[model samples]
Target: MKIAVVGATGLVGRKIINLCEKYFDSDVDYSFFASSKSAGSELEINGNKIIVQELNDDNISNFNISLFSAGGEKSKLFAKKFLDKGSFVIDNSSAFRMMEDVPLVVHGINEEIITEKTMLISNPNCTTMGLVMALKPLHDEFTLKSIFPTSYQAVSGSGTKAVTSLEEEIGLGDDLTPDYSDGFYERPIAKNVIPLAGTLLENGYSDEEMKFVNESRKILSIQNLIVEPSNARVGVKTGHGTFCSALFENNVDVDEAINLISKFEGIEYWADRLATPLDAEGQNDVLVSRLRKGLSNDKILNFWVVSDNLLKGAALNAVQIAKHVSTL
Candidate 1:
């Protein structure tokens, strides 16, 4: 198989490359591509350094599968061409996610949607990726009616530059901090939280927040499922934490729910301890804990979710989908 990783220098893209080296067959031919500024730079994988190609129409084809973690605009520009040229495009951007024809996939949840006919696939936002993985088994058992999530996103999700802004503010203090500068968030992110993670839309929901609302419904195959989402940027370097309150159509069974999630494939639950982003950092598993009652209602339950925004949230899930699709 021939594989390509777009946005090869990025945090998510680097992880995708590492996993490709680990899981891809020894005979697989792999390449990396990036923006013109980063095009000639080197990305090292499995002790070999490979030069990144500039992303353009001429150079994107001839690959069996192309994993894209470039921003939405670039994915919008490049994905279709790759798909049209017979490379299965697994996009890690919100660009094609809400489209009717595109399949937004989580590896185990709705991965069956990626058929031999599917040329393009959408990977969910990093935050929503963890959220839906934890919700699927519960949605299967009790039939989810509504979900509310408050996400604490890490700075790494914003990309390499945002990480620099955060580091500068942390390492050097206030003098370097302007009101807000390039690649930094709207406000500071050191030892403080910014209530918004994405641009505020007309509906008062940030784009990051709506990904939870929109992508979860799509991945769980629940068209009518209602989601209320709140997103914030924290000072953490990696891993995103989400606290969720869910309501089901039937009465919530704590024991049965616990069993369903604990035994469910991709997520793990801890009964005695609360799971944090620190515990989930650098890990692919969605660490879920804190199952309890909310609103004192038998139908409502609360849980906490954590996962590395780069690994499971972006790269691993994309590769897992590609792996599953390769078998069929």
Candidate 2:
């Protein structure tokens, strides 16, 4: 199979290229794409340096499989063009996720939903991916009624610039603080936490918060499921951690739910301990721990979930979808 990776110079995009080279069969052909500024640059993939190609409609039309990690604007303009050229698209951006026709997939959870007809598959946001992996099994055992989630996301999710900003600030030592530059983040992301993720919606929730609410429902096939989310940027580097309090339609037994979550694909359960962002960094599986029963209703349950935003949230999930589609 021939594959093209869009936004090849960016953080998630580069990771996708590396993963494809490392995991995919040696017979597969790989191409990399970036903006005009990054074109002609060389990127090493699987011990070989590959030149980055400039992204254009013509180049997009030539690839067999295109994995897009560029922002939504780029995806909105070129995704259909690639699909029109007989290429399967697994997009990591938020472009076509909620479209009625697009399937937002997490490999272990919804691989069965993919088919040859699924020419365009959407990968959910990093935060939503981690939460759903932990919630899906419980939702299956006892239908989910509502969820209140608060996310502490890492700086890496913001991109390479944000990661550099954090590292630069941390290098300034404890006495001297680094100032926020307009190019990096809206506010200082070095040692502090920012209460916003994406832009604020008319409904007063941030776009990142709404993504968790909407994308979770779409991926889990739970319509009319009420979700309240608060997304914040933390000082961490890679993982995204979420705390969720949920109410289920049927009474949920704590022990049973814990067991079910442990067996859930792409989830690791730690009943007696906690799953921290540091523990989840660089790992693909979503980690769940600190289970608690709601005070008022036995149907209510609470837990902490964490996963690598770049892996489960982006590249790994996109690659898994490609693998799933190849099998069909």
Candidate 3:
């Protein structure tokens, strides 16, 4: 298989290259693509140096599959160009996720919907990916009535620049105000929590919070499901942790729900132990723990979920989509 990784120099894109080499057989051929600023740079893959090429229509059309992690604008501009050339694009951005034609996919939850014609599939936001993976199995037994989620997302979710900002701030003394070079974040992300992730919409919700609410319903195939989400930026470097309190349609046995949740694919249940961001870093599976019953409703349940935002949230999901495509 010939694979091209767009945005090959970014955090998520770099992780995708590593995963493809780690999981796929030695026979697979891989290529790297990046912006003109990063062109001609060499990326080490499987102990071989692969030169990164500038992404353009001509170069993109040559690959059988292209994994895009660059951003909404880059995806909006180049996705169709790659698809028009008969290449399958597994996008890790929110650009095409809610589109009527594009399928927002998570391999363990909805791998069956994937087909050869599915040229551009969108991976859900990192926070949403973890929430849905933990909720889907229970939603199957008892439909999800409503969800209230609070996320403690890592600085890495904002990309490489944010990571640099945090490191620089830490290096400076506490009294020194962290300088915002490109205005990456509204506030200093070191030793502080920012209540917002994405821009605030007209509805008073940040784009990140709305992504969890909207994408979860779309991926789960439930139109009227109610989701109340509050997104926060924590001091963590990689993993994203979400605490969800959900209500179901019909009363469900707590033990059965726990058992069912434990069996859900891509999720590891830790009933006695609590899952943390440090534990989830570099892992592909969503770690779920801190399960509890809601006090108000017997049908409601609360739980905690965590996963590597760069892996299951982005790179690993894109790689899984490619694996699905290869099987077809």
Candidate 4:
């Protein structure tokens, strides 16, 4: 079988390429594609050097699956092309995520929605991927009512450019000036936090914030679920952290909630210490900690979650979806 890794030169795309070797059989053939600028550049896969091809109509070919992480625009342009070629498109972009016909999947949370008939799958936002992983097990046991989540997302979510920008800005330590000349973020992000993560809508919520609301509801299959989202971009490089205050229909036992998260698939629970972004840097599982009852009600629970934004949040989940569909 053959597989295509679209956006192969990108941050998440590279992760997907690295993971393809781990998840797929060694015999499977792999092709890498990037933009014209990155095309002709070489990348190593399974110890063999492969030239990155330009993602265009001429390069498009029949493959069992195509993993996409370029951007929404690229996905919108190229995904259907792959689908028409009888390939399953696992997209890691905002494109087609909320579409009724497309399934927005988080690996362990809602992967069962994928079937033999499924071809196009959308991976959730990096922040939502971490948030929902911690919430799903608790939501199943207690019936989630509402969630107020504040995300401390890393600059890596914006891709390699943002990561470089953060590093460059950090080199100017204590400059205390907003310089938009280098970074992908609107404001300075070296040692400061940007209040908004995505384009702000008329409703005063960012597109990233609403992704937490809409994608969580869609993935969890709770149409009326309430989500109050506030997302911020932090100075970290890899992991995305979220602080969630959730209310459930039933009273939650702190012990039981901790136990539930501990045993849940793709999650690691820390009982004695809080999980930090640095701790979650290379982890495949969502790191969850600080579980406790809310001050006001026993039915409310508060916790912190962290995950490698590039891994479980984007590329890892996309590859996992492809692996699952390959089995089907």
Write the candidate numbers in order of decreasing TM-score: 4, 3, 1, 2
Superior candidate under TM-score, 1 versus 2: 1
Q: Per-residue lDDT of 155-271 in model 3, one digit per residue for the tens? A: 999999889888877676575465543335787777778888888999999999999988999989999989999999987889999999999998867788779877877888887
Residue 201 shift from truth in candidate 3, angstroms: 1.1
Task: Please list the residue runs of candidate 2 whose C-alpha ends up more than 4 Å from where it truly belongs after superposition.
Answer: 175-183
| Residue range 1-328, candidate 4, lDDT tens digits | 8999999999998999889989988888889999999989999888888899999999899999999988999999999999999999999999999999899999888888988888999999999999999999999999999999999999999988888889898888876487555567888888889999989999999999999999999999999999999999988888999999999999999999989999998998998878899998877889999999999998999999999999999989998999999999
lDDT of candidate 1 over 18-96, digit per residue (tens): 8887777767777899989997889887777889999988886688899999898999888888888788889999999
Worst 10 residues of 4 by lDDT: 175-184
Candidate 3 ranges beyond 4 A from true positions = 176-183
Per-residue lDDT of candidate 2, residues 1-328 (tens digit): 8888998899889778778876788778778888999999999777778899898866664566789998899999988889898989999999999999999998888878888988999999999999999898999999999999999999999888789878887776574344545426777676788898878889999999999888998888888999989999988898999999999999999999999998887899986677899988878788999888998999999989999999998998988888778778
* Count of residue pairs whose backbone atoms collide, per candidate: 0, 0, 0, 0
Model 3 C-alpha lDDT versus the unseen true structure? 0.87
Best by TM-score: 4
Model-by-model lDDT, in order? Answer: 0.87, 0.87, 0.87, 0.92
Estimate the TM-score of every prediction.
0.95, 0.95, 0.96, 0.98
- Best prediction by lDDT: 4
Model 1: residues with Cα > 4 Å off, grouped in runs: 173-183
